[model samples]
Target: MPDSTRQRRPFRREGPDLRRRELIDATLRVIASRGMDAATVRTISEEAGVTPGLIRHYFETKEDLLGAAYDQHMTTLIEMSQQAVEDASQPAVRRLARFVETTLSTPVTDPEALQLWAGFIQRVRRDEAMRRIHRTNYHSFLSCLEELISGALAARGRRPSPDDLKRLTIASNAVVDGLWLEGSALPEMLGPDELTSIALDAIGAILGLDGLNDDLRKELDK
Candidate 1:
């Protein structure tokens, strides 16, 4: 006779990091589709296919989860931007050009990304944790830009002083941020090609590298 009760297969539990990320992703989706006010524990749990208690187990408070989500969102943006600048085989100018092109393109400049950012920006002003995350991510992005700018300028035989490089990085970041905001908020107003061209031209002029746009255009043509 067969055993009356076969042992059930052991359940596979999700790793802590993955579970946390899933929760954060769920939170973003809820906020994206229905605004930040709808991203309650219960709602996020439903989206993540877990119980509200599971959320509480991972995050002590709703604000903590929100902060985590914001951190994840900003960190992902910085990472993608870094990845865009990672091709060492390309010349520094082309690398900088790629960085600008990727930043101004889809996913990075999507309406949903803008929505997610807008949803978190207000909280960043009031919440200390959120503000810290913002500052850290902002600096990470600036460092990447500064590195690319340094390489590009050096390639052109123009090595800027540290102070000058600092100013240039800030200015370049401002241009990219402004254009990114406009492109994301009003996608119809400027296409990706136009945005990339304007960013490359503006940053190139700032860094004294006049051929960035031309270089990128030539690469694309080839």
Candidate 2:
């Protein structure tokens, strides 16, 4: 462990949100490495180098802490796309490509992200807060997707129907989800090159990028 982590192990912050954030991060690190069943308050507190009581101080139950961690991770992931979409330098197509790349590329494509996501997704069926967070991120990224798709299509004077936009957004999100999982599960088997080729081909076909110059195709492939 680094000295910074060593010094911060006690996690004795005065603010509730700050303390909760620390514990939530601890929950992620622990649950990401060990399975969720192993993520007791004792293990998480030990991971945070704080006491189990501290977890209860913020979260009434282990489920609450787990939900908070899931929320934080999803918020982080959504904000990544927000930042990428803020880049005004690229054209709409390239910007869309960058958004897809940011979504499907590493550390987001790492096993830790998928493991944490799988844990949270399983819990969502039972946990109301987790379910809300699930819907929140989906809607949040759906808005971003709508913007990207609308911009890319409108640049060519085509505006999809609201229903079509909704369906396409979900499909695009599913494509990213698949790429993320495949990369995390079989980085060696699929490799980034193969993953990129397959993903670009699929997304391009879906977005109607079937015809373009070699340069633009290479740009999208990038």
Candidate 3:
């Protein structure tokens, strides 16, 4: 039986972008806390405080929403890393050093973040859409690293050719990725300071920018 005048509540309207972001954030949280298997539309809707219909309204399928969530996660990580390298006042070498430092530090190198990444990475191979998103984000991050490396090399008056720049970027990225994984997975064993120091040393050596060690020491002392 329906009440004649029970003061029915009106639904609050949210912008499409806001709604989508909320859903994506909810998906990431669910995946990070539980596993990807637990990130169903019903679960995500509950997390976002929305109706399951709303999720279907925003996304055609569960896979689409998962892809969007992965996209948001990777975009955020890349933006944070890019922002770290965007200090115009600092020289290129220092900015590059900052990028390394930022990537190996909190929020970016977090355990929950690692969990979210591990969850999505499993789908990256078998899922075509997820694979595309992963490839796009990987290149985006790599491009950022390449730009920083180019600028740092130019600051040292050493202009690497296109091939050399690509190689340098790949090698530097490998160092950062390796350390980021280890630090995120073993936070107790690898503190931020140690992670950044090892990353800068290894990357600096590869780039022939030995001065990076001194730069890092100065930054830490500050």
* Stretch of 10 with least lDDT, candidate 2: 1-10
How many residue pairs clash in model 1?
Answer: 0
Task: List, residue by residue over 1-222, the lDDT tens digit for candidate 2.
Answer: 222444335434378777778889899998899888878888787778887787888899998888778888988987876787697767777677667766766766777888889877888888788899899888888889778877877776878999997887788778777887899887777776566556666777777764322324577567
Against the true structure, candidate 2 has what lDDT? 0.76
Say which candidate scores most in lDDT: 3
Error at 71, model 3, angstroms: 0.5
Which stretches in model 1 have alpha-carbon errors above 4 Å?
1-12
TM-score to native of every candidate shown: 0.92, 0.86, 0.93
Writing each residue's lDDT as its tens digit, candidate 1 over 1-222 gives 222254333436989999898889999999999899888887787777777898999999999999999999989887887898677889998999988899999889999999999999989888999999999999999998899999989988989899999999999999999999999999999999999999988998888889899988998999
> lDDT of each prediction vs. the true structure?
0.89, 0.76, 0.90
Candidates ranked by TM-score, best first? 3, 1, 2
TM-score of 1: 0.92
Judge candidate 1 against the unseen true structure and give its global Cα lDDT, from 0 to 1.
Answer: 0.89
CA displacement after TM-score superposition, residue 169 of candidate 1 (Å) = 0.7
TM-score leader: 3
- Please count the clashing residue pairs in each candidate, in the order shown: 0, 0, 0
| Higher-ranked by TM-score: 1 or 2 | 1
- Encode model 3's per-residue lDDT on 1-222: one tens digit a residue: 222344423468989999899889989999999899999887787777777898999999999999999999999988998887677788889889998999999989999989999999999999999999999999999998998899999998999999999999999999999999999999999999899989989999999998786896787699
